[model samples]
Target: MTSTPLPSPTSTSGSTHRSPARARHLLSKVPEVTVWFWLVKVLCTTVGESFADWVDARLGVGLVATALVFTAVTAVVLAVQMGLRSYRPAAYWLTVVVLSITGTLYTDILTDERGVPLAVSTAVFAALLAVVFGAWWARERTLSIHSITTTPREAFYWLAVLVTFALGTAVGDGTLELTGWAPGTAVLLPAGLIVAVAAAWRLGLNPVLAFWAAYVLTRPLGANIGDWLASSRAEQGLGLGTALTSGLFLVAILAVVAYLTVTRVDAPGAVDEPGTR
Candidate 1:
């Protein structure tokens, strides 16, 4: 045959475009709901409770001063977190740890310093969390972290996170008051409840409902664990001390975050494909 005109470059360009679009579509898929995610999340909450105690009780910083310090630090870390264009586990987790400590302290101040009853604090924070969830769902139509792609969604996510920590602290302490159980004994209830929730989830419970329920439960679980680790043997704990507990958990968090950052293990929201929308 006569030399066929070279196919127009547009054809080759279209093929290239299609390939990249597919690749991006795959990349945009949210991370798998992994064990590592839950593990690290629990660790962060543990650090939050223990770190706040260490600063306030052991260091004699006082609750207000400690709260101020953690708030300032959280603000700085959160700024760095927001500046990242993609997921960075180290930055993200660091921000979370700080937020956890700060949120716990906020509840403590309301309960301890101002003499607010745990029940009242619980009710107030519960209402606040409800408001956050309502606004978040109203605006984004989804509260699932799996779909967090935009800045507004991320803002809502963090807001909900802060409220959850505060609410969890209230609920945990409230339960202790009601049950009059030692910290070690108190740990079992939340821990057992969480296990039950996980079992239920595996047995066909709704994923979103299970996820949020577990998320709320984890705060108290981690808090109880931290308290058990740090309290004196007289209090039914291991006598780790708040400082040791905080340092131990913080180091573990750092190691895990470093690994995740290097491996890009939990980054989210990559470029979307043309047809994916």
Candidate 2:
């Protein structure tokens, strides 16, 4: 008596097969989302706004020059991040920090220097982001940040991230231009929007949709926070000045990064640190 023949190669079990490349990619490249993730991200975007201003105006570096410098920094650090096999807080955040600055400068050039209308810039960035996301989804079939373990997916992820920062810059500035709202008041809107997104997420909204919605809102919220802290009271801010504001946020970000490094609280695939929310 012989055993029954095995199922054909097209069976559902084949669905789990992995290529060597994809197997290597199984080591996640991004950080686990946590409270610290949002905290540092907001601070990074804040520095993106205030630090760019300090370099351009306070230090007299000029916008184009500062943009060029940060663009170069982004390229370099992004290379390092791409080379890494696993999540590294320092390199990952460095890319984000530089990307934030680059994105902000880009919007500033379009609006302030080239005299492009804020509404137009907002529309353009929105279209560009849509295109990138469309391409990314068409190719990978998914945009969840959790799946960014492969090179192609990682590239798509970063491209989307860059566009998000740029889009956020445009939206944030456009909101202020349209309403003529003060930083104190301007921030309230995005802040409210974020709270609403969080509530929706808790109330069974799609986690991915909620995550991205909050991600985009955070850019404007963080940028407004930067402006509010750096701008003079005459302009509806706390009047801390850009340099001081940048320094403070930079320090706070560094401290959080250090903590994450030691505790591995945000390490991809690692156990969540005890007491995490």
Candidate 3:
């Protein structure tokens, strides 16, 4: 009747230790949580918002058709990602960028094409995220990103990320609809909430909880920022156009990912964390 010990928070190399066989078989599939991680995440989210819109508008195809195309692309990218034994910054972030686009499109389809209300979409996506989390926790007993060293854990992680993007889209757009606020003004709420969550994490909140909270908030914050740049002056945006905004963010993401790939700074088992470097 011995009890399994809970994992230590300060695990070696920022991850729970495993045997050589296990380690060799299941290299970490996620990047270390660092400033670069957050930066790229926000960039991907911004691209999710603007790029999807730009593609749909230019494709001459309907929303549902656009969604289907992206869905197929997402499946292909995710398959490639899951097949990898170790984390590659390019593959990993490419998958994320596609997933972000796919998720945003899914929400747009529900609200714009299928005529589902944003409130309903938000509630549904939130419930889906909760179910994914619950099932993951029930099976794995931990939700820490550092534990994503197996196929099942990685699957759960990706599923949770997709749902969060959809839910964030629904909530962000719903707020705009309800408040009639301009996109620039709308960005402030999620941005401020993210800051608050970070402060709470500094003040003893759980790191896992804080990370996911900030992750969810970033979708809306980035989306609103994208909208503000793309929308016309009449809409209180800078009128940069979706194409330009997407291009700028894509280049920024490439630069960051390139740095990480060359330095391996954010790779799992890296010695230096964000600030320490």
Q: Which candidate wins on lDDT?
A: 3
Candidate RMSDs in order: 11.3, 9.3, 6.4
Which is superior by lDDT, 2 or 3? 3
Model 3: per-residue Cα lDDT over 1-277, one tens digit each: 1111111122233344333354334687888776778889999999999999999999979888998999899989989999999999999999999999999999999999899999999999999999999998776677777777777778888999999999999989999999999999999999999989888877877667788888999999999999999999988999999999999999999999999988887787664332211
Per residue, candidate 2 scores C-alpha lDDT tens digits across 175-216 of: 998899999889999989988987876676766567777777
The residue pairs that clash in candidate 3, if any, are none
TM-score leader: 3
lDDT of 1 by residue, 215-263 (tens): 7788998999999999999988999998899989999888877766666
Candidate 2's TM-score reads 0.88
Ranking by TM-score: 3, 2, 1
What is candidate 2's local distance difference test score? 0.79
Query: In model 2, which range of ten residues has the least summed lDDT?
Result: 2-11
Tell me the deviation in Å of residue 3 in model 3: 37
Better of 1 and 2 by TM-score: 2
Ordered from best to worst lDDT, the candidate numbers read 3, 2, 1
Deviating ranges (above 4 Å) for candidate 2? 1-26, 58-61, 271-277
